[model samples]
Target: MCSVEGAKKLAAYQAVDNHIKSGYKIGIGSGSTVVYAVDRLAQRVENENINIICVPTSFQSRQLILKNNLTLSDLEVASQLDICIDGADEVDCNLNLIKGGGGCLLQEKIVASCSKELIVIADYTKNSSLLGQQYKKGIPIEVSPLAYVPIKKRLEQLYKGEAVLRMAVNKAGPVVTDNGNFVLDWKNFDQSLDWNKVNLDLIQWPGVIETGLFINMAKKAYFGMQDGSVKVQS
Candidate 1:
C-alpha cells in the first residue's frame, strides 16, 4: 500500500503539473505537503526553463524557494498572483479549510486572498464531510502575544470551547508565528454552527490576527487517495 506521505507527494505533483505555467507568479504555501509542490515547481523551472516567481507564505516556504533554486519574490512585488498552491489541515465538502497547523495561516491566507485562484493539495486523510471531522488539532487562531490570555478567555466565552495556547515542542514557550504572533488552538467547536458567521465573529475579536477557518476561499482541491489515485474537488 502507498504510504500517506506518498499520497501527499502525488497530490502536490499533480497540482503543480496541472496548474504551473511559465512567467506566472505563484504563491507557495507552507506545510509538509507543499514541499513536494515546491520541489516539482523547481524541477519545472530547471527542465522546462520556465520563468516564474514564487511568493512564500512562511519562513519555511521562503527557505524552500531558496533551497530549490526557484525564483523568490514577495507579495509587494507580485501583489496579484496567478495561483496559490497550499495544503490544508482539513478540508470540507464545500472546500472550506482548516489551515495554520504549521503556524503560517496569516501569510497563507493573505497570499491566497491575493491570488486569482487557490489550489489545495492534500492526502485523502485531510478530506472530510465537514470541518473538525478529520483534523482534531483544533482551529488555530493567530493573536497578538500580549493579548493571548484575553483572547483565549474571549474565545472560550464566545464558542464554549477551550482555546489553549499552542506550545512549542522543543521550546519552553508558545509557538510564535512567522509574524511574531501567538497561536491558540480552539477545540470542540459546534459542528453544525455556521462557519462563515463564526469566522467573522472570531476575527472581530480584539487581538485576533486571523483564524484558521478559510471559508469559501479555495477554488479547487486535489486529494490523493490511499489507492494511489487523485481526486479533484471544486
Candidate 2:
C-alpha cells in the first residue's frame, strides 16, 4: 500500500519532472523530499542526453547530485541558473516558507536568489492557511556562535519569546551550519504572531546573518496533496 508520505513524495517527484527540462542549470535543494527529485532527474539524464549542471544548497545536496550521476557545478562558476527546486518545512498561502529544518537555510536562500526561477516542492502537510500555523517553531535563525546568548535575550525581549540555541547532541556541542555559524531554534511564543512583521523584525537584530523565513521569494510552489493531487500557487 502506498503510504501518505509516499503519495506526497510521488506528487513532488511528478511536480519536479513537469518543471525541470533540457538546457537548464538546476539548483538542487536540501532535505529528504528533495532526494526524490534528484533521483527523478537522474533517471531522465540516463535515458536522454541533456546538458545540465546542478548547484547544490549544502554539502549533503552536493553529494546527492554526485550520487545520482548529475553533473555538478559551482555557484561561482555558474552565476546564473535557469531554475531552482527545493522543499520547504512549511509554506503559507503567499508562498512564504519556513525552511532550514535541515540546517541549510543560508546557503539555500543564496542559491535560490541567484537563480532566475525558484520552484518550491513540498508535501501536503507543508501547506498552511498562514505562516506560523503549521510549523510552530518560530523560525530558524543562524547566528554567530559567540552571540547566541545576547541574541537569544534580544529575541525574547523584542520578539516576546525564548530563542533556543540548537545544540549538537550527537557531537556534544552546538549545531554548526555549512557557513560555520550556529542556529537558534526560537520557539514558544506567549501570544499570537504577526508572521510578516515578526519575520522582518527578527532579521534586523544584530548578529543574525539570515532567518529561515523565505518571504515572496518563490516564483512557483508545488504542494503535493493527499489522494495523489497537486496544488499549484504562483
Candidate 3:
C-alpha cells in the first residue's frame, strides 16, 4: 500500500505532468503540499526546456522555486502567467476554496487570478461534502495594519458573522502578513451560506484586500486519497 505522503507526491506529480505546458510561465504556490508538486516539476526541469517564470506566493515558495532550479519572476515584470497550481485548506464540490491557513492566501489568490488557469492539488482531507465542512477556521480575511477593531465590528454587523483578529501564535502580537497586514478569521455562520453575496459584501469592506473564501477560482483540482487514488474535479 502507498503511504499517505507517497500518494500526495504521486498526485502532485501527475497533476504537474498532465497540466504543465512548454514555454508557459507558471505560478508556484506555497504550503507543504505544494512543495511536492514543485519537487516533481523540478525533476523534469532539464528535459522541458520551457521558459517558465515562477511567481511565488511567499518567501518559502520563492526558496522552493530557487531550490528546484525553476526560474523566478516578480509579478510586476511577469504580468501574465499560463498556469497556477496550488494547495487549498478546503475545497467544496463547486471548487470554492478556503486557503491562507499558511498565511500566503493574499499572494496565492493574486497569482491564481492572474494566471490563465488555476489548479488546486490537495489531499482528500481538503475535499468537503459542502463548503466549510472540512476546514472551519472561517475564511481568512487579510486587512490593513491600521485599526481593525472597527472593521471587525462592521464585519459582524454588515456580514452577519464573527470576525476575530488573528493573533501571532509564534510572536507576541497580531500576526502580520507578507504585505504587513493583519488576518481576520471570520466565523459563526448559523445557517447555509450565500457565498456569492458574502464575497461581494466582504470585498466592499474597507481595509480588506483578499478573503480566504475563494469562489469560482479553480479550473481544476486533484485530490489524493489514502488508497492511492487520485480524483480530478474540473
Candidate 4:
C-alpha cells in the first residue's frame, strides 16, 4: 500500500503536471500536503524550464518557495493568478473545502479568490461526502484578538455548536495566525446544514476575519488513492 505521504506526493505531482503552464503565476498554499506541491513545482521549474512565479499564502509558504529555489512574487504584483494549488483539511463532492488547519486560511482564501482557478491536492483520506464527515477539527474561524470571545458566542448562538478557541500545541494560549489573529474551531455543527449560508453568516460577525469553510471556491481537485492512482474531480 502506498503510504499517506506517498499519496500526498502523488496528488500534488498530478495536480502540477495537469494544471501548471509555462509563465504561470501560482498561489502556493500552506500545509503538510502542499509541501509536496511546492517540491514538485520547483522540480518543474528546473527540468521543464517553465517560467513560473509563485505567490505564497503565508510566511511558511514563502519559506518553502525560498528553500526550493522557486521564484517568489507577491500578490501585489500578481493580482490575477493563473491558478492556485492548495491543500484542504476536507473536501466534499462539490469541491467545497475545510481549510485553515495550518492557520493560514485568511491569506489562502484571498489568493484563491484572486485566482482564475483553484486546484486542490490531497490524499484520499481528505475526500468526504460532506463537510464534517472526515475532518473533526471543526470549522476554523479567524477572528480579531479583541473579538474572539464575542464572535465565539455569536457563532454558538447561531449554530448551536461549541466554538472553542484553538490553543497552540507547543506554546501557551491560543494559536496566532500569520495575520496576527486568533482562531476559533467551531465543532459539532449539523452535518446537513447549508454551509454556504453558514459561511456567509459567520463572516458577517463583527470580529470574524475568515472561515475555513471554502464555499464554491475550488474549481478542481486531485486526490491520491491508496492504490497509488489519482482521482480527478471537477
Any runs in candidate 4 off by more than 4 Å, and if so which?
A: none
TM-score of each: 0.98, 0.92, 0.93, 0.98
lDDT by residue (20-48, candidate 4, tens digit) is 99989999998998999999998988898
- Residues 1-234 of candidate 3: C-alpha lDDT, one tens digit per residue: 667677677678889999987787889888878899988778777776655668898999999999988988978988899999999888888888889988888899899989999999988788886776767787798988774777888888876768888898779999988989999888875437788788878888788878887888899999888888899988
How many backbone collisions does model 1 have?
0
Assess each prediction's global lDDT (C-alpha) against the native.
0.94, 0.83, 0.84, 0.93
**Taking the tens digit of each residue's C-alpha lDDT, what string does model 1 give over 1-234?**
668999999999999999988989999999999999998998898899999999999999999999998889998889999999999999999999999999999999999999999999999999999898978999999999999999888778878878999999999988989899999999988887899999999899889999999999999999999999999999
How accurate locally is residue 19 in candidate 4, as Cα lDDT from 0 to 100? 93
How far is each candidate from the true structure, as Cα RMSD in Å? 0.9, 1.9, 1.7, 0.8
lDDT of 2 by residue, 94-114 (tens): 778889888999999999988
Candidate 3 minimal-lDDT segment of 10 residues? 188-197
Find the number of clashing residue pairs for candidate 3: 0
Q: Is candidate 1 or candidate 4 better by lDDT?
A: 1
Order of the predicted models by lDDT, top scorer first: 1, 4, 3, 2
Give the best candidate by lDDT. Answer: 1
